[model samples]
Target: MKVALLYNQKPDLPENTPKYQSDEFAEWDNPETIDAVANALRERCDVVKIDCNPAYLQQIITTLLEEKPDICFNITEGIGEPSREAQIPALLDMMRLRYTASDPATLCLALDKARTKEILSYYQIPTPHFRVIHSLSEGMVFLNEHHQFPLIVKPLHEGSSKGIFERSVVYSVEELSRQLREVIEQYKQPALVEQFLSGREFTVALIGNGETLEVLPIIELLFDHLPKDSRKIYSYEAKWLWDDPENPVEVFKCPAPISKELADEIASLCKRAFRALRCRDWARIDVRLNEHGKPFIIEINPLPGILPNPDEHSCFPLAARTAGIDFNALINRVLDEALKRYNLAI
Candidate 1:
């Protein structure tokens, strides 16, 4: 089988870029990650890499038409509006081409955390009670609400922990207002302020489609190694800047040591959220417990990160390893699942 690997390489920003601007556009696939996926696919199929930067998007379609690959192993993470993640899939669909990962609709809906929560709430899926604040006036509504504090705020349309930092958790109306202003002015997007989940946090990685969907080992995020003043949430610094591959932060514990009952409950909630969001091929659902130990969906990544290096702190790959699937095998498994979904013999 011929596989056209579609992806977005992280941009090489100029040295003088303002730190804030750099952080806003920092979510892109690392070169090593793209190479890892291609190498894995090369073991079982002819691989042709196509960078899906909008500047040369036409080249992707041209390569697909000329090379006539059987399918596209897409991992494109475009920039711009919240719908950016779905743009490449939408293009492929227009050309009647098959690709991996969720469809454009699911990608768009899931990318917008506010919309995803609304859908989850409608389906009776437990999620943090939240509100989207477009301005400081909108944030005033939170002051009167009886919801408990240590509220967490994040950009409505970002991933990879962008716009999230230790200061994202607010304990008072003043703190909430300051954070809201930062999100609106810096990210230019509404801020999603939710009642913080104070209990343990775990991320569940799933592969395959429908009844065959396989939930990999659950991975817990530990903040014990973090600085004393740092909040428990996974901040951007912890994900990208501070942690090192050679000496990774002791943050992840896979196959989380939990009771069978608790594990089953967490898994069930993930599967429900995955199906409710209409996710296909593969996805990573983040679940966190509240004070009572009940699980709630924090977010779902239809296009989960697959950082090749284990020490980079990529949760999906870590969970796959716990399930006895190595990096190469994990990549191929995803492709095989997509092939099966499209009714193509592997």
Candidate 2:
């Protein structure tokens, strides 16, 4: 078998530059994780890195067709446009190339928080009520209605907790509007203001094909050190503020403590959502409990992080380990599922 990594290799529009001519941010799906997966594939297959940029989709498509790899370990996150993450997958779909994770349509839908929630709601999966605000004026009015106090605001198209911070949590209408304007001005896009459900948060990792999908262990964010006044959200600061020397999101804990029944309920709902979205190879579903302990999905992460650490905040990998699958074994399992889907010899 032969494999290639499709990834975004550009930065976002720089703050100072005009939207049309800003320097791009560099994103390569992270080389270490790709190398780990590649090494795992090396045991029985050949792997290559195709550093793809969303702006160069035509080039990526031409290159991939030329290489004709047996499979692609798609870790691409498109840069610039809202549909950036979907670019590589869309090309693969057009070329009839086999890749991993959710399909192009699903990727596009998933990246749009509002649309994803709409699908989940239609399927009867529990998620927070949210309104997509395209402008600060609309936000100001919507804030007065349709939302309770203590809401959360975020840039609709960004993932990995981008544009999310402690101030993203609002306890009053005024604060919500202020945050809304700030987000719109900074992100230059609509903001998703969601009803905040304050409680324990967990991530469920899913792997495998249609009928044999396996839900790995539930991972929890232990908020033992979080202050009573602060909201328990995995915001940008909590996720990436490594240099502040005083960051406060407590360490994440895997094999989250919960009753067997609650765990089963989460796993069941998550599996349903994954199947509904037609996710393949692997994905992560993030769910937070309401005050009453009911699971309300925060969101689905089709492209999950598999950083080389079992303990410090890599939930999916931690869950995989809990299932008695090592990193290499986990990667092979995902590959096995993809190969089976493609009906090729493993």
* Model 2, CA-based lDDT: 0.78
lDDT for 81 (candidate 2): 76
- TM per model? 0.95, 0.89
Candidate 2: segments with Cα more than 4 A from true spot: 9-27, 54-59, 242-250
Model 1 Cα displacement at 29 (Å)? 1.7
Highest TM-score: which candidate?
1
Model 2 lDDT per residue over 33-126, tens place = 7677778878888777787864565777778888898888887877677787788888788788888777878778778888889889899999
User: lDDT of all predictions, in order shown?
Assistant: 0.88, 0.78
Flag clash pairs in model 1.
none
